[model samples]
Target: MNTDRLIAVLAADAAPVGPHVVEWRIASALSIAACGAVALLLLSYGVRADLAALVATPIFWAKLAFALTMAGAALVATARLSRPGVAVGRVWAALVVPAAIALPVALVVLWLAPRDARAALLLGNTWRTCSLNIALLSVPGLIAILAVVRSLAPTRLHLAGAMAGLFAGAIGTAAYCLRCPETSVPFWATWYLLGIAIPTLVGALVAKKALRW
Candidate 1:
């Protein structure tokens, strides 16, 4: 076909697209995964017995805030990455903000604590299982997030995967909080962060093949 003819045919095939619904789709997937995760939590690790009494404490909310904040940031980044060539301006900063805020606070808390107690602050009794549990809990959410991302056109496959993992990990941590007895910010900053990193690394490694179109 002639160049002009090919151009005309291509133009004729173009159609107007509707508003994007990436958030809704991702939310639906995450919601489904969250339900499964909740079930897992109920069966394997029920909520802390003192949840009712701890509800009024600032530390409890702090734990929730850390997870939710990172989840929000990761969600924004994942949405921006769903499109091709879109600049996710400062969206990644959201991920860093939580750590930035938490680090300083953790530092201060440690500074104010007695030298003998610093070790306990850093490694709570559940240190051996904390990160592992977070990573394990993230499995369902990771599957959901990856499935949602797979349906989209992501040029940066690895990054999209990592962001999805971040979202999943945070959600998992939040769920784990229901049973997590540790209330130390330092512990959350260290171990919880490691748990989230596990999925992020896995996503980055597998996304190349999984997201290949």
Candidate 2:
């Protein structure tokens, strides 16, 4: 009841948290939410009917590579930002490398395509809904990741939130690939990028208030 007694009780209840705990928490939260996002996508959009045929295509793998690589990089950034006083450092390179490789390849592919096909490559059939679908699928992840970060010790609220958003958005885009029938490199590079960007921007905007300790 008294100050001295309360101090003793607090000391007795405290336990030392190891570094592995942090990794496990973030990894588990993201993984679980990713599964949910995929399920949500499946329920709403259904898997592409020709997924088996698409699997053998290079473009399918390329699409996965883009989203997965982005997610991996964002995971690193999110991990670093979850802790106080941690610098992002070369995680920026990890994040940029995917775009650096994918964008150039996309541009080259666009250049060589027939003029008429160029429009399809950029817009695809679902251009109106592609980014929106990805963003919607990411809701589960965004909520879960933010909850985990809030429970941890993040000092850079805005940056931390933005990184979390990017991570979730990447994962969402990856899930959306299962439903997306688009075969254009340019479309992935542009529309998928926008999907992830939407969440990242939203995260940064909300982090200051939502992540405030």
Candidate closest to the true structure, highest lDDT: 2
lDDT of 1 by residue, 92-153 (tens): 77789989998898899899999999999999899999999888888888888888888878
**Tens-digit per-residue lDDT, 80-145, candidate 2:** 898899899999999998889988988998999999989989999999999999999988999899
List the global CA lDDT of all models: 0.87, 0.91
TM-score of every candidate relative to the true structure = 0.91, 0.93
TM-score of candidate 1 to 2 decimals: 0.91
By summed lDDT, the worst window of 10 consecutive residues in model 2 runs over 28-37
**Which parts of model 2 have CA positions greater than 4 angstroms off?**
1-12
Superpose all Cα atoms of candidate 2 onto the true structure and report the RMSD in Å to 1 decimal: 2.4
Clash count, predicted structure 2: 0
